[model samples]
Target chain A: MNIPSKLIEDAVTEISRLPGIGKKTALRLALHLLKQNEVHTEALTLALTRMRQEVQYCKKCHNISDGEICQICASMRRDKTVICVVEDIRDVLAIENTNQYQGTYHVLGGVISPIQGIGPEELTIESLLERVSLSQEDEEEPIQEIILALSATMEGDTTSFYLAKRLKEKGIKVSTIARGIPVGGELEYTDEVTLGRSIMTRINYSTE
Target chain B: MNIPSKLIEDAVTEISRLPGIGKKTALRLALHLLKQNEVHTEALTLALTRMRQEVQYCKKCHNISDGEICQICASMRRDKTVICVVEDIRDVLAIENTNQYQGTYHVLGGVISPIQGIGPEELTIESLLERVSLSQEDEEEPIQEIILALSATMEGDTTSFYLAKRLKEKGIKVSTIARGIPVGGELEYTDEVTLGRSIMTRINYSTE
Candidate 1:
């Protein structure tokens, strides 16, 4: 009844459930799918099924993993005593792509958002504290540092503040990732890279 | 090391194989599918698998069907003596949606395109002629009409001309679906209601 076949229209309906796809674009996608062979469709289905089935969160640090522990968590070559906490798995991947952080990661799943009913209970913060404290029981040396790798959004700042207060009570060194202009989110709209350097130079958080 | 997760990147690669989907939009689609629960993913996979596995073209008309005979071919109410030849299965469904004709269809798979290397042998032209001849053998009334429902493109016009010549040799009255403007493609963005009226007033094609 629509611009294309019933099969095409049905495919469009399924695709339209995505976050930003509209009906017209959905139709375009569906028509495209129809033209492809079974191999292509099978590959897509397999990827989706694998993403759901293979990927899970690390129990110790909460980073995304194909196993119980993520690559970073299992790697003895990295600095296990330094943990970088982030708001989501996406942030972890973004940080990992930079190949700079030798420390492991903790993914909070989401920021604390009162409107969306997300709170401390909904996050992996408790597990993080437990992991940091696990150092005392195992003779692996106390967690020397914690890096707050949350976004620079309002919620991210609030979450970092909450995390900082809690970690300070337990007597661990804590620091936040700098609030400099993001690699892509903007910089001369922020020559703020220079301004950020000034802030880092003037930093006065406890170094322990 | 790409802009998105590896699993997401893999899914996008698969989805981009569809007819018109590009890499950017496919990435968005893959991300959307990942965000959904197991049930949504499972449903989509099932639909995709069924589309490839369960669907087959009808022996009689070439329209997509779950059985040897398409739904239209199996329907007793349809007039067997009038066969509307269409460019593809999509066109058959589009006409069926109109509910204007009681006749069955014969899908040509595609129009004659020398540029694309599609010729009469590549189509269902032989099968169509055999079907007409078989009707005569079965003591059924001779096939009275053959309608060419194709797009108003150059290839469509050429195909219609060739098909009309073939059917007229067999003594069947052949016609084309009216073309003043498309129902949706644009007559300054046509309404289907106006398009329907124009179909009723269509002029006949002359060999002259």
Candidate 2:
């Protein structure tokens, strides 16, 4: 596109650096910002800058936080003995939104993917292993379970297997979330692997 | 979504304020930024802030510029006699990208839309009229034609009609861009209004 001003062009280039945003969308966004109140743009930039510079990563779960530890990990009511292992903070938020899990989370950063040159070391796997091992000696609240809540992808499975092997010596229960067709999912569109797994892991029908 | 960090939530809220962006996309963008190098975030914010704070509106045509006069208006090679009147800077950029028009532009900011409480008074129509009237007295390069390159929407047509009536008194020739099927538009799916207009405005074909 033939941008009239160098300043607008620079802004568009920067905005388009984000994933999913194209040059056209970036230009539209830039123009929208220009048309809006100056304070609106100022607030947006301020928020983004503060988020990038001041946001903290939890020391325990590695989830993003405002301080040294995330709220989920610091909460007293949460199940301290259980840890939900997932790919990243997004998964943590997704599970939290479900309102089903009362346990804490251990964000792995990402699943082990050799093709992308992402191994166990690249993720937070080492810290998870250390946490699990150290929890065994904690007399007050020893960790009882480590739930492998990672995705059902090949990389996720590989990471789960590796974690299970490491946590086996710790004597903590290692389990995984159930894999099945989603609540509103139609059987006709369901993939064979998931369908087969759902059937294999079917529970008893009790019409309560 | 359950965002763990307050800073991330703030950033997401601000990012979602842009047109077409939703809360989910905003969170995804925020997380993507968090994963990227800090310098990238800094560059994006700095560019946006600079664009918002330093960008100038051209005094002559109301198009955004880096100086008092836009590059197009200041260019010696551009035609001073013909002015392409458009709704906004985006239209100007679109026309410039075609590399066909050599005339300068007059940006109206927006078209007349009573539904949105926007009228000729809200736009730069008065300034455009002033520019055209003043050009007639100029000894050199007096403006001769005012081409209306507005959209085919109802508001666009209303704005064009208003301008045409106003410019008629000044004795300047007023013309509009052709209304027809786009280069790759399919007649089967084309709307009746556009297809009818295309037939009505058909130009004679001459073999080269």
Candidate models: Cα lDDT each: 0.75, 0.92
How does each model score on TM-score? Answer: 0.65, 0.93
> What value does the TM-score of chain B take for model 1?
0.82
The TM-score each candidate achieves on chain A is 0.82, 0.92
Please give the distance, in angstroms, between residue A17's alpha carbon in candidate 2 and its true position after superposition: 0.6
Q: B122-170 in candidate 2: lDDT tens per residue?
A: 9999999999889999979899999999999999999999999999999
lDDT of 2 by residue, A1-208 (tens): 8788999999999999999999999999999999888999899999999999999999999999999988999999999999999998889989988889999999988889999999889999889888987887888888999999998999999998999998887778999999999999999899999999999988878952
Worst 10 residues of 2 chain B by lDDT: B199-208
- Candidate 1 lDDT at B142 equals 65
Task: Record all residue pairs in model 2 with backbone atoms less than 3 Å apart, i.e. clashing.
Answer: none
The runs of at least 3 residues in candidate 2 whose Cα sits more than 4 Å from the true structure, single-residue gaps closed, are A200-208, B204-208
Candidate 1 wrong stretches, greater than 4 Å: A1-51, A74-83, A97-103, A111-119, A135-208, B2-16, B19-43, B76-82, B98-102, B110-122, B135-142, B152-165, B178-208
Encode model 1's per-residue lDDT on B114-134: one tens digit a residue.
Answer: 999999999898999888878
